[model samples]
Target chain A: DAGITQSPRYKITETGRQVTLMCHQTWSHSYMFWYRQDLGHGLRLIYYSAAADITDKGEVPDGYVVSRSKTENFPLTLESATRSQTSVYFCASGLDRGRSYEQYFGPGTRLTVT
Target chain B: EDKVVQSPLSLVVHEGDTVTLNCSYEVTNFRSLLWYKQEKKAPTFLFMLTSSGIEKKSGRLSSILDKKELFSILNITATQTGDSAIYLCAIGANNLFFGTGTRLTVIP
Candidate 1:
């Protein structure tokens, strides 16, 4: 396919355990983002990468780490998972060209921490 | 802090009815506003608005952004069962700020 994809569509981890969600995009977009979708919180950006090796924190980045070693891959890691981290995580990609800033999302990974 | 707020957290309407979803934002260095339609999986892109007054349309769905008012509205006409989904509004600046989203249900 020629779109974004996430691995382990569904995941479950115990509290204090480490978990990582993988995201890959085939479009080679320069901007990749990680977001968590919760009940009351629609989608809060956890981290984003402008390009390979260039990452920045977003609205909600605590307890989470992200790396973009390659342009097609951006993975999110939870150092110590907590029950509060249980939510649907989405990965998106976009271009940082002119005035267009629209993003395309992946299927999303449902993570549960108990 | 930058923020995006959506109105009418949830809505229910008949199949043939029309609905409008609102999104207001308070973001610094606002670049653009985007809308997405989510069913059970990832949210699909709907529209991206940067300028004001100009309306963007696709099939039965349309949206307009008001840069001066710092808000946007998505409208769906002749809604169908497939129109039932969560409509998300996001603001683009340094990154993207998303609203809680509006859950719309179109009943037969």
Candidate 2:
């Protein structure tokens, strides 16, 4: 109950539709991140937040948007979902700026776009 | 760009066997290395190693990092079917950079 959690563990939407995945962390960590996992690509960061209302893009930021209005919540939105956007999404919170800090991940949300 | 690479893309082993997962990295200002076990969902933290905390162990899982070599290894002893998962190795720079991950499957 004190850890990170994701909503709608599984989701499906049609191409061009808008979809949003939610993440919540109770630790109130200063740093939050969003990543996508595909078959061979491993986990690629899509966006990261340093603090409330401050967010930055990661390696794969295209086709996605993230906002952090509060320390406990970081939501990822797919403005126009595409078939390639179907993948597992993970949310993480780190106590520090990532260096020498371990991250705690949420359960993950699997999205299928067709 | 920062990068992490893992070896033995996939492995199949029988229960009770021992396995080693390898991870190497190239990053600016390396700070730490981490290992995680991923089953059906997100990855759970198994070990975190830094210059100050170079070795960490829990149960049958153990890991160590070598700053000189810029690499790390994770060893699983007397593995069970429950150990079947994707073993991920990540290197922490200013941000965390993950390796390709090793897919381990243990059969009983």
Q: Please write out the lDDT profile of model 1 over residues B38-88, one tens digit for every residue.
A: 999999999988899999999999999999888999999999999999999
Docking class of 2: medium
Inter-residue clash pairs, candidate 1: none
> What is the C-alpha local distance difference test score of each model?
0.92, 0.90
What's the TM-score, to 2 decimals, of chain B in model 1? 0.98
Identify the runs in model 2 with alpha carbons over 4 angstroms from their true place: A98-100
Q: Clashing residue pairs, candidate 2?
A: none
lDDT of 2 at A19: 98
Residue B1 of model 2: what lDDT? Answer: 75
Q: For each candidate, what TM-score against the reference?
A: 0.96, 0.94
Q: In angstroms, how far off is B82's CA in candidate 1?
A: 0.4
